[model samples]
Target chain A: MMGLNKKDTSLFVVVIVLALLAPFFLNPFPTDSSMAQFNAGYPDLMQRFVIFGIFAVGFNILFGLTGYLSFGHAAFLGVGSYAAVWIFKLLTYNVLPAIMLSVIMAGIFALLIGYVSLRRSGIYFSILTLAFAQMSFALAYSVLSNPKFNLTNGETGLQVYANDPQWLHRDSLPDLPHLFGLSMRSTYEMTVGGWSFSFNTGYYLCAVILILTFYLSIRLFRSPFGMMLRAVKSNQQRMNYTGLNSRPYTLAAFVISGMYAGLAGGLLAAMDPLAGAERMQWTASGEVVLMTILGGAGTLIGPILGAGFIKYFENIFSKINDNILHQWFAFMPDGIEDFIVAVIHPFIGKGWHLTLGLMFMMVVIFLPGGLVEGGQRLARLLRRKKSDESPSADTKPAE
Target chain B: MGILEIKNVGKRFGGLQALSDVNLSVQENSVHAIIGPNGAGKSTLLNCLVGKLIPDTGSVTFQGQSLLGRHPHEINQMGVARVFQTPEIFGDLDVMENVMIPCFARRDGSFRMHAFETVMNEKELVEKAEQILIDVNMIDKRHMHSASLSRGDKRRLEMAMCLVQEPKLLLLDEPTAGMARADTNNTIDLLKEIKEKRDITMAIIEHDMHVVFSLAERITVLAQGTPLVEETPENIKGHPKVREAYLGEAQV
Candidate 1:
């Protein structure tokens, strides 16, 4: 099963099936029905889901396995996006080169940043990364967007323009972000009974990348290098005395994860040919942290689950307005109905952060292992119930 | 010359001199013990050998190469392995994995990506690690998490981790400190077995006289950051200086 052991192979298969069938699975409601707003089968959001899933998976390599909390991952992501867009501007609208350059550029930046930041550990390491990300953000926003030499193109963002020298661009190729003639935003709509689904070229591309990257991450987790990273988290003193340098191990992880972030960022730019300074902001860095923890930090599938969970919630929850809340609570008495809507209002729409905050806190406090732990507990409970129904449990003494 | 040599080593921390004018050498294939009471600079001397602390004066050399200014990992790569007072096994890793770490470090220098190959695929390393586990009588607990093991088991795991490296010089800092009498005896037997089977040189620092007398071929008594006497266990037994250092404890 793709060189993975039994458990990892099964998990990989599950993820692959989910990624390929996301459009159908996400659009579980009729298009004209009231639940249509909850449907997340659209191409744009689906691409985001896989892209951020890749980001969290990469971040977990450093933060989850090595216990190095980096707060500047978005800098690499932003750097990737900028590199991709520059490729579009300088070379062509084709995404292949953009994605490749993005990874390489991000790797170079990560080498520099990681070499400096990895000198410290714990909160100081986190602060060092956060400071670097903020500096990158500030530079991208103002300093690098100068009139004489514009690298980031300032607050307006860097985008492909008609006047730009896209030397490789031709009349036959699609002007939009694409692989050759295949446009990224091109979608095929199919209706089965009351349900409608969109299978997008871009989402599938992102899905393929996600699946490949996810498999690579699994290999990393099972490799000797992965074991070393875990040792870095467990006991650095033991690791050092065993003739292994913790610094190089962590730096390599940092660079590798940075490249993953770059891959994700390139995908984002490929989906939409614009790289904005906001993409490099600290909030964006923090979002991936939330995704990794909310799902499970060290587990292979946890980050993907977490990314999907946070992105899905962010989309659907933010769409809910006061009107929607009032409609849902209309069955109650007049005063109680208003109170119910008022209570729910703060958790939806513009107040989505409150909900995310609450969920993050609950995950950290009760489910320290995150959503994966919750799923494991459920599986254990179900197993217990099944065993209890059988005579073997009562007849057998507890081990 | 000895495998590891300390020439007039000195170390200071703020207002206090932790160790000063210390000179000693651990001969090849012998168990050398540095025994002293609390705050007697025994641990500081061990730290200097393992690269944890750099002496302000004099040199610490291993196999004729200076151990000074080198990182712990670099020193370890030069065939010097250390076991801590408290069993500093990788607590989060399982038993077999804990032992295999030093094996990996031994096989693959200070750093290697090894990003793709599965650990199980390295049959050679796994077999070597398992063999060491067998030698330590811990093959049955190979799959168990190191943290869940009893203190005695943890110490054994730590010992296995060091021994798998087959270092030229093995530094043990109070290897049986805080152990129950039965556990201490087991450790002594383990050390004796290890000595019988290997060509390794051991440097042990202990406060327990029973442990020192049981394993040490040579004993160095330290008092107030200076060596009082360096002698064999038979000669150190009735030495007046040893008696004074131990406050007339008949156990010496």
Candidate 2:
């Protein structure tokens, strides 16, 4: 849990390679093929995959390290999105200001919340944060909605229109933001052995930022600040008695993680150019907690894996209908296919969450360390079995 | 003025008087031990010294500066660090990392926001922590998790955590409260070693007479939220008031 072991480092490398190569290797069907239902190669879904990955990764920094169960984290993400949207409307449409504003705003929000909430630990802290988040949600829906509709654009949400200033629009820019005069929004394509893939410019940008954020989180996880957070989590009283103020350390972690959420929100708005109040909903906030816990709370890469797994299931399961099930079971007998469809049909629409819930339960019950510990257990079992088999083979020399 | 002075400090929780007008002081670089029975408010006094509890009455002055209203970390930054009754080292962090935290707080006064520079690469902090670890004879276990150490070793690590700050005054609450004879002897030796190597003024609260007699230069006997006697350990060992206050009731 402290640092990456050799096996984990190799696994991390393998996972990164797989994530990069997934579009070409996993999605074999044409873009418009009926089998595209299972394909997560689309820009919209891929954007979500990374955006939520950032969200859960930030969350793991707080709940995972400090064991502070914050029920109001979504408020930070929502506030971040709103701040970013306002930046887009007021200033240029470039991502730099939007992201900066989001991070700063979220940090300020966390400072206020953490100042009050950190006074009490455990259930009290959770309740305090929950109440604050609800208060924010209420304000966003009620006051921030109609009167200053120009800022947030209210229930309709803020969206970019043709009339909006296009400072970031490449065709209009006198001197565009480019690497060696090449537009940042350019993509490079590659094809091999009847398989074609396009690496998206936006996706690459998101991937790069995520990697940087991931690196920062890793550095933080290994630092003294990180140690203080764990100290706060383990025993606040002891820490207080030890002439250490646990409050400031907890507040710092809260702000840093909140900034990450803001960055993610800004990136999401950059990809799609819309900021909706619904994005900051408590359910959305809870979704990242599920991802972090299901993946592995303390492990760095676990949250990303958790985010991808949940999003993959969410997209695939929600899209499946009875007709799609029938198409898959066309090769089987009518009786077996109908039985299988009947068993799975109820969990297709709103029921996709039921599957997520079951997966979360399994991960929690059987693998409390999340996917990271599960992987370690599997590796250990394989090594043991190998050693046992080799010894047995030597003993059977006569054979 | 005494280096670390407590004047008429009293604390009340509901109707219970945890500490009532308890006044004491330790001169610089002296080993001062505060002894009391269970629930005698020894910890409550230490809490007041380190700014954990705001006293209902009286003033706490460190080197003639007011200590009230300062946060614990700020107090630590101002050269006052405490080791807990229970060893409170960061369990997940390695020993070196655990020690490095106080060094960071001492140097920066707040968590540094830079994510690029490695904390270990800070030469002064690493050298200071390494030196403290050497003093505690825990240099060999510096790479291991602080939690993985034995009880005595955890106490040593936590002591190193405070020592890294180079505090003017240090506070210890029941530092050897729960230990076997061998571990207690080991802790006594470690404290003796640290005392000789560092110029730190420590106020230790102990239930172990052996530890108090072996380490403390001066002893303060606390009974019923008040200081009964403040004297040298030699004088404190034979005092009738202390004997009647504690030893008469127990086998000590």
The digit string of per-residue lDDT tens for model 1 on A188-238 reads 999999999999999999999999999999999999999999999999999
Candidate 1 C-alpha lDDT tens digits along B44-67: 999988889889999998999999
Please report, as a residue range, the 10-residue window in candidate 1 chain A with the lowest summed lDDT: A390-399
Best candidate per lDDT, number?
Answer: 1
- lDDT of candidate 2 vs native? 0.78
Candidate 2: TM-score, chain B only: 0.94
Query: lDDT score, residue A160, model 2?
Result: 65
As a whole number from 0 to 100, the lDDT of residue A44 in candidate 1 is 91
Report RMSD (Å) for each prediction in the order shown: 2.1, 5.1
Give the least accurate 10-residue stretch of model 2 chain B, judged by summed lDDT: B109-118
Q: Give stretches of model 1 more than 4 Å off.
A: A391-399, B248-252
